[model samples]
Target: MTSHTWRLQPEGTAHDDRYDARADCHRRLRGPYTGLGTLLRSLVPDAHRARPELVAHHAVEILSAAPELKDLIGAGPQTLTSLAVPNERTRLYPAKRTRRLAHGIIEFLHGHARERGHALALRFDRVDEADHTDQEFLAILLRRALPDLVMVTVHTGGTDLIPELTTTLAAHATHTIAQHPDEHEDLTDNHKLALAYVESDGTSHDPAEQAAYRRVDAAERARLHDQRAAELRRSGDWSLCLGAIPYHLEHGSDREAAADAFLEAAEYLVSMGFYHSLLDVAGRGTALMDPAEEPRKYWMLGTKVTTALAILGRPEEAERRYIELRAMFDQPMLHIFSGYALAMLYTRYYPAEQKDHQLAKAHLNNVLAMASLLPDHDQRVFQSVFNRNGLALVELQLGNPTEALRLVSTGLADIDRELPAEKHRLHRSVLVHNRGRVYTALGRLEEALADIDTVIELDPNYPDYYFDRADVRRRMGDLPGALADYSESITFAAPFWEMHYNRADLRLELGDLAGAIADLGYVLELEPDELDARINLASLLREQDDAAGSLAQIEEGLRHHPGDARLLCARGLLALDAGADQAALRDFDLALNAEPDLVSALANRAALVLETGDHRTAVADLTRALAIEADNPDLLYNRGYVHQSAGDWESASRDYTAALLLPGADRADLLRHRAECHLALGDPTAHQADLAAAESAASSPNAAADPVRS
Candidate 1:
């Protein structure tokens, strides 16, 4: 029989006979096989690397010439390799000692078969010491070597399939061939012969192994880190990359192996969208991967950064890392996570210097420009949960609130709710919290509340939920409810400026002036830029007759938001109360100019105008105020006073009439004011009617007379 091409890959240490036999097989046949002579003519791992096809042809021509067993090796115009062989038990796992070696040889042979069809051949192993009937072992080896091939195996030992190998191969492999559980007391000798024949015949095979299958752990079984590294270095084959990395990672063949392993994982992760698993295995993926992977890399990097920033307290370094990741990734979700890291980094430990946004943007833009090439669906869905989370945050940052909500909702929908209880709770809580934020931003307060409430129910321990939900409740006018939530938030995130400010607002509403003032003070301490808190604190102090504190608060607030209209208005009103009309006038004028329809500003300035003897301008201000809020008692009464001063009795009477229609009309106050106006106009009878009405209504529920300080 003629021999077939066979590449000799030395196994074990350099001195072993087994290793020598492998090397001898190739060198001895070098001159005999013309195909090998042509193939082995070139070099490898160099400028003259030989082609696999050439090497294969040469191997075939030489190996067929002098086979010790012609029965197992042949070079007929047949389908397989250049030889035909029979199944043998010796090669069937090779009796343990040779099992690993047998696996390697078989694997390489099958790989040759895949690279060049009918140019390689192998023998199959059988169970029951029976002839090889296309055994499952053969099929598994083929699938690993050439996944597209169709082959089958027989399982004589009745049991359920274990799919550890299914991870590397197909999920399913074969069916039971042992017809009866009782061995054959039920079948005659003739029936037994049929079983034997069928067992010895080739039956099951599939080109596409989509169905489930039994696993075979040959790769792991044959694992030898040192041997594999030596082979890879010699073969210079790219296909061996997976095996090499695992060897380095699992064993660290040498000191350099650990670093090499990390580099390989990094490259793989960078190539595979920076998959979270690769990151988990790599220890700190951000330290290894390039930022060009965009959202994927940013997310993985964010976790490392968050962990480092929180523990090591290297906020400056954290910010720098954040910038690098942001440069490579511009997705909204990435922005959010990185934002959280950077925010925490700065909030807990601010940098002595500012960030580098301009440089950061250029890098991030590169990622965006590349990511934009992917279809919209690619942006809508990410393969990894980390990437998906990053994508959602990116949507939030970019003002795509609708998309952000959709992504968060979809993300939660895709998860199995019955997972590890704590893990599930954490995931659900995070999802709901994020969704709540998006909804609130969209002004869908009811929807936002539902999400926030779910998050709170799922994990009340998380602080941001309380603070965030408190903000929503406040917006919905649930002051007491908002206060409760804010209080809880402060309990969890005691130092947060947002929670303090929100609670302060609720405290003011509940008439807790001291609590409100205290909260506001803390808020300013946390974030000096909080003008609203400062103003609110001043206003509350003024209500409590703390003139000095009130003025001090106003001045403090102005230091931060100097041009704030609300601050100006509040300050002007306080100045007026202190009888500093000129100071008040300056503020009110500026306030009104900032917001022309400011009711309090217009009204205050109207009185100031009167004090300055600008009757025409004061009338104009009062008339405009009444137009803005006709039902406001102060505006109506003030406008009437302006009209009366102008001797416009018709306008003055109209204003008094409108004021009397307001809630809790203050019958005594209205009648007294109106009676005076009528007397001034020389209407005695009208004044008499007004006096009668005033005396009767003064003690009634319709009356409440007290000056309201502006």
Candidate 2:
């Protein structure tokens, strides 16, 4: 053990020389190993390494342009669309995907640390030399990509080295875009060099950086890209600018219709370098055009025109342009946009009659069409916006409040996302109101109350939201809440005719008949054609037995919204109360003609028809009413009365039996009717049993409170 060391003395001199040179090479090459250190140094030069990928990476972030941008920039004197870049492609999935991709790259770097930061640098050329450790390269990439908060500053040039030249360029462009959130948002290919200043101590800077960022020679840059940039350049000239100014007297740029024409003129003026015309357009409107979009691709010009008209309450003009643009190219997105526009137009004015119904249906159909067209990755986006609103409208139109409530609540539950967030928070607020309406109709007080609360939290300014909520609160027997919401709604915007009418109805509910009458008076003054308000006011007057006053109100309302179905229905109800059966029947028939599917009209008409001895016609009307709301206690009782009056005791007994299974029905009365049927059929035992069961069920107040509602 003590003599284990072996001597390496060579026996021959010549043999020793060969071994010396070989060992010297080995000593030089091995950093620690010996030999060939100089040989390795000759091939691998580390100090001048370049990292272009870092620059490109930053370029990608800073230059994302809108898909429609090229057209705007190259509009060739058509005027630029100045809305600027479309927002970034955002989705919740990105959050999930980023963490996983980062984790994998990070783990890979841990295994090969020598090439850590260098590995992420994008390489455009072939490499024939030995490389750094994979772990090192991977670490380098992970460092470049780790989000700002977590990623430390990367020193690519060792302790003293600034980031590569390309990285500096990328950082500049990125920093500029970051500083100016309003402009430089679109990260398109052309804006690549603009991101060089994202991070700096203001020490090491690139000579090419200023050259790239300067827009002083925009004309030259345009020429650099050949005719496309030239086209963008040509559109910014003065000749086209002159035509942009409005020369008309009278209806000047201040008018909404003229405003649209003024914007179109601006496009011409800006393109032709007509600064004077640009000034005129600016005088007419507040929003400015972008110089970048010199030849401006006419902006969402169609969208703007339609929106302006809709705002001005000119649905005819809005619809014309909406249709014109919609037909230019047939895509499902157009349907969503058009339908939304139409729905807004109708909703804003509070359309009545068949037009409101038609618009509502069209709106829903458009949403469905949009859903059908969405890409797989994007399908959930529209769902997040429209699911509750469109479905609730369809449900209300179909008169299935329970089904509507169930579906809409479910839709709200599924809107799960995070971070940058969904852009339609305002629209979602509207959906909350829509759901509240459904719940109100279904008489789900507590659930409806919760939804209305959320709607207020989302948007207090939306006109219809408050009215819908007030209606819900009134149904919940909260008179104070209902009154407050109604008052708040009208206070915010007096042009909302419906809120005035709603407040009036709430006043009547609170039994302040005078107050209700006064509110209705105000509503009618603003909207003389509001038949519902007039009818309600008339009914309230009639309730106070001021028949003359009621009759006068009805006549005046009818004069304005002449022969409205709701008015006829109200007048008929009044006549029936006045014991004018013949007159009541005539009025009900007229009401049905105006709105055939009106449940109140059908039920009232059927009762009149039955009393008039037309049992066959009475039964048909009752049957259809039952189809609409089979669970309506009044409708069911009326149908039973029809059958009994028609001399069909057996059929009459069945109708009464069905009525007993629904809400608000007098179980004792049903038993008596059924017993009468049994007596007529000589069934004493059946009659006795019916009498006992009805009395027992009605004896319990708790039992009576719940309905057999089937």
Candidate 3:
């Protein structure tokens, strides 16, 4: 098999400021996955052939995040509505979404390659100017996809790509080419030049074209924008609204139309979880209008931007913008909306040290007060219940589970009493879900399970509700039920590594070691840098006597997380198991230096030192390990053995006595050791009592071998 190359060149140039070049390409191509889908369709012309459902599943997954593609994908109204519903229970972060997309694409490619013995090559130009969503998708695809299945050549405008994309190119690209620009064409016709620029969605980097386009009068340029926007609107491809339509209208003659387009796009992007894009488009819309004159439109855009800021981890900026907007707009609805947003910012998005539940509660109260002032009684009731759900979350975060439960109950009651069952279905589901969470926190597992079950019935398509129900079932000791729920969750969504990770633990608990291993391996495939999954997988592989697999996992984890203490300690234990004592000692020392209080490293190192007859060092290591695990009988027993070996009878006697007092202690051995120590310390009465206890324990059926000796 010949190895294919993927090239990326990110070039920086002037006159590329109008729009994101790569995003424009994406819009023109319909979506990020369209090329792959087209290739698959070409490979198998019959729509029934080659698992088209897989392709459609992934297409739906991408559409869920970028719903503007509904027109291009021919998604039905019901399908679009289902995909558009915001999943409040689980926040699928951008990176995870990228990983899921990459996984789905690779799966599709592999299936195609299996049936049709052929490889595909794809190229993308101006990748540096791609939007965050496209860049992240390309970066993950480059890193994870097999080279033989698909070769990607990315011609970045410059080397100014995002850090992740740049790193992926540097590490994965097979060849790098630097090409100098040729002489620019003499474009004397201003009309032709401006047309070319607009037709390309402002992706023209030609200096001559740029200069000619700039020479065109503003009236003509606005006329061109208006024409382009009308053309895109007539094309019936909604995805263009995310890019070309909005870009054209923003530069069009009508400022109000531009603001309206941007506001619509902002709301669409926000729902799609494209917060960075939402922030940009919303800011542009805000710039085109005055807050004082267009307060409602301005507040709508401003609130979306504020939400984007908070979701993007800029809480301070979000807070500042919220305050600025609130001061500018005195409307009750503005206060209600912005107030709820600010409350969520404090309750969820703020840094841990900066989070203030009391402050969040105050904001929620303000939202409720504003809601009451609304003229419409139904609006007041709906807003009150909606904001009260947030207040419940704040109370939960404040460690007031009872109060949170009460708040959730009141919200549910109001929704049921005041609103029709069909009204506010989404919010009703949210309240039920929040109530479930509160019940779980309050240790009311049955109630939590009931609430989760109800929410799952209400919104059966959402995966997080199943995951949440699984958790409650797990806590309720319904292992089989929890396992089924977890499987159902995985089935409902694309690929949630977290659900797999949790299910792996559940499988392990149920003694399905193979299932646990498979789930953990899948988790690593979805997220390679998942250190906890790596560690658990390594340990599980070792349990199954696959030492090589375990070592590979540890090495791979170390490659990502060098000097990680848990990994190092695990490596040390593996080395010791293989009789590489010096290597084990070195790794243990390194692990300890990285984390001094690492109990496992300390205890294992104590064992190694004891083997070398370093009794004092062994005793010191065990003593420190004991500090971290005060009630550990094994550590106490080991320390007693080391002290006894060092001829420290008093210390040995104290340690042995402590070990005997612990639950599940090796009673016969501990008693015998304590009797010997007591005799050595000349405590005749204590020695006699311990000797009698030792004899009695040895005869007991429940007695086991000494852990220290074993």
Candidate maximizing TM-score: 3
Ranking of candidates on TM-score, top first: 3, 2, 1
Model 1 local distance difference test score: 0.51
lDDT against the true structure, each candidate: 0.51, 0.50, 0.76
Q: Return the top candidate by lDDT.
A: 3
Q: Whose lDDT is higher: candidate 1's or candidate 3's? A: 3
| Residue-by-residue lDDT tens digits, candidate 2, 204-254 | 134344335453255443333332223433555221122212222102223
Report lDDT (Cα) of residue 380, candidate 1. Answer: 29
Instruction: Name the weakest run of 10 consecutive residues (lDDT summed) in model 1.
Output: 87-96
On a 0 to 100 scale, what is the lDDT of residue 525 in model 2?
Answer: 55
Question: Candidates' TM-scores?
Answer: 0.42, 0.44, 0.90
Compare candidates 2 and 3 on lDDT and give the better one: 3
For candidate 3, write residues 54-96 as lDDT tens digits: 5465564545444444444445223222543442222324424
Scored by lDDT, model 2 comes in at: 0.50
lDDT of 1 by residue, 1-710 (tens): 11112111122312122210111111111111111112212211111132344323222222222222122233312211111122100011111111122233233344444444432212211122211111222323433443232122322222222232222123333322333332223333443333232222212122111111112132432333344455445654332332233333344234345445444544432232212223343444333434453346435645543443443345565677677667766666566446544543433345436443333333344444444454544332222332344456655655677877787777676543323333333444566778788889999999999988987776655566778888898899887888888777644321456667777767877888789889988767545566777877787888888888888887777766776777789889888888888889999998888888888888888888887678899888877876888778877878777787778887787778888888855667777778878888899899999999888887776468664625
lDDT of 1 at 289: 39
